[model samples]
Target: MVVHSKFQSDTVLSYSGSIPYTCYEIGHTWEPGCVKTFFQTFCDAFKFSIRVYTVFYLATFVIKLRKKENRRIKKIKKLLRDILQSSIFLSANGAFFMGGFCMLRNLIGKFYGWHGLLAGFITGILSIQLERKSRRGMLALYLMNLAAETLFNMAVARNLIKPIPYGEVIIFSIASAGFMSLFRQRNGLPENLHSPLTLIVGPEESRDFYRNGGNFSQRWRLISCLPYLQKLLQRLKTVHRSHQSCPHNNSCTYYTLEGIFKQFLLGYGIQILLNALQSLRGKQKWSKVFNNISLASFLAGFIGLFRACNCSLRWLLDRDIPALHGALSGAVAGTTLYFYRSTSIALYFFFKLMEVLYFRGIREGYVPHLPSADQYLYASTLAIILHASCCEPHNIRPGYWKFLCGVSGWKFPVMFRKLFDVFGTKATTLYPNFVPDLDPRYVKTTAVMELLKVHGKWRDPTNF
Candidate 1:
């Protein structure tokens, strides 16, 4: 009777198991439920975050080591501090932008993958408030972010790895890299424009010293005997001074225009040379190359004209609303790049103007002062989060990316340097004959340095 009961129970159990069980064991089951999926995703995200942070920390450490030779303790402390700051900034930016992008994608329906472009544009604009960097520098950083993201996307498309949250990766990379770059010391002077005079004498003194200098020769020698070039420069200077004395001489229309013309000519010549090389490489017709050269030259000239006009307008309205002046100048510059639909240029300048005003307010104590570190952390976190959570990515056409890529090759750097000069950063000395790697410190003769010392002493009688 007991054996008969056991057989019956086993038969009943087998009968139940033959059908799929509601919550547990069944004939077959494969789906991971919501909770399990969520946990898995969370684990993946955490791993990704750690890997990214490690890479960033290592890169930053290497850069800092190369830049400074501090003692071991101090170096380690600095590295730790920077890492902490970078991690915080990146985490905040990533969390915020990711939410924002997801929301935008839902609302705008993807926009043909142009959402990335919009995110990048916003990133560039917002970066200005956090770091005192040139617009070109900010743009370059953003492009780097985009390129990295694109490469990752390509890898995913090729099934190199399982699908992962790339948006998070991009935002983190950009924030970390941008923050890291804030600490990088600018070369301050371009290699092409390096000169003994520039190294010894400051920018203002060098400009004054070279005011009567002649045009650059074929060999880039600063020859003073070029009668026609000297006459033309004198006339331009005269016209520039005809207007009210600009508060900032660097912004003077005449000087700005002259600088623009010089830079344009140099850039145009270089473009022609590069085109020749390209033609040889591709075995293209000379006529086609010549046509391209003409087009490039025309574009270069247009950009130079627009920049000169912007500088002039800023100088003319120096006394009035400075912010408005900046906006107008930016608008004018943007108009010139209208062919490329570069409205971002205007937006960039507007933000730059606002940033300047904010700084001024802080200095004058009109604005409440916050601790620098706290301010950076808080602002960066807030801006990125806000952007990510609330905003949708505005799609930019793919053609625009191609156009930008074409323009960004070699000429972009030269163009950016000219813009830097316009802002009076003196990033490149105007000296035509300077060679790279000629350090002033190694020279045995202290004649020039001694003269400068005496001149400085003369200017400041208190020192005597």
Candidate 2:
């Protein structure tokens, strides 16, 4: 009797037989079973948390090392510390909220769609309340969450991406937004901040500094040129004032509007240049360039109008409720752009009203007690463990991933430099003839020589 194997290496075997025998390849890998999957998920979650903690810790450490004697440095340090604290709290709160949302969704089987929306709304409110102590921050978080959910649903409807489980997505978005808002809250600086130029040079000297072609740094190059720009503005203002007799109070408004318009025009010009360059790179036709220019001009004009309106509102109210003003201006912009649908518009309005009510509540001594730092940490650990056990891995992309990637890319060069320093020294000493190219004096001296020259020149008072 002859027997045939039903399986072959790297191929399926076919045979007609009453009895079947299967043979397996020696080197093929099998799919992960339940145990392996659980271990892998746990490891991934732990690594992610560690990465988050390490990145923030290192960043804060770097900022702390800067000279803190200067007031600006002190303020920057405080801002960094506050940011680190807020981020840790927000991440912890978000994880807890997500775990609860997933649990609720799993428990409730019928009307999955309604269950998801309700869960998302509740999670959003709770997440915002826990993540931020300020009423303004909370309101902003709520409105942004609504807007994001609306956009995501629209994208799904249009088949831009696969349908997401809204509950899971909402939880992920809240966490992602919390991190983003923490960074963006103060324009990547401390809150209620003055310009660094104003801080560095007193008001009297700042004019001269600007007049001298401000060379503070690459970031503040624009500020250095501001004095020259302002002089031209003043000249134009004088021309307008001489042409028309205007009261001082009315003149201030006119000047403010004029500044807004000037800024808009300047930005429009820059946009056109950038669009032209992009068009050249992409080999776009003239029609596309015209469309780009037109769109850019429209956006620039809208931004200018929004700023003018915001300034007017602040001037009239004589109070600084930037959150309220921002929402109102954003609504106008949204309406002008035809960006939001009826549902989203209504939701926005509802959030605006809620923001007012919430502000009032806080004013009336209704501030909610927030969780302590220790509690936040404990909750985060528990939430992470629960999520690892019960939920599939979340694949939501963060808005700042590109920024983080750019930051992390620097590590490779730094590591390579350090390795070369250590190995080059040892290799040159031990095997000079065999590894002559590894000598640190030859390979790494160029940068050091350049720095030495700069230092020597700067040390001579004549250079300064």
Output the number of the TM-score-best candidate.
Answer: 2
lDDT of 1 at 50: 47
**Clash counts for the predictions, in order:** 4, 1
lDDT of 2 by residue, 132-157 (tens): 35533543544354444445543564
Whole-model lDDT, model 2: 0.35
Off by over 4 Å in 2: 1-39, 49-232, 239-254, 261-303, 306-357, 365-464
Please provide the root mean square deviation of candidate 1 (C-alpha atoms, Å).
Answer: 26.6
**CA RMSD for every model?**
26.6, 21.5
* True-vs-predicted CA distance for residue 428, candidate 1, Å: 51
As for candidate 2, its clashing pairs are: 214-224
Across 45-103, the per-residue lDDT of candidate 1 in tens digits comes to 34444455668777867776765575378878866665554443333333333333334
For residue 50, model 1's alpha carbon misses the true position, in angstroms, by 6.1
lDDT of each: 0.36, 0.35
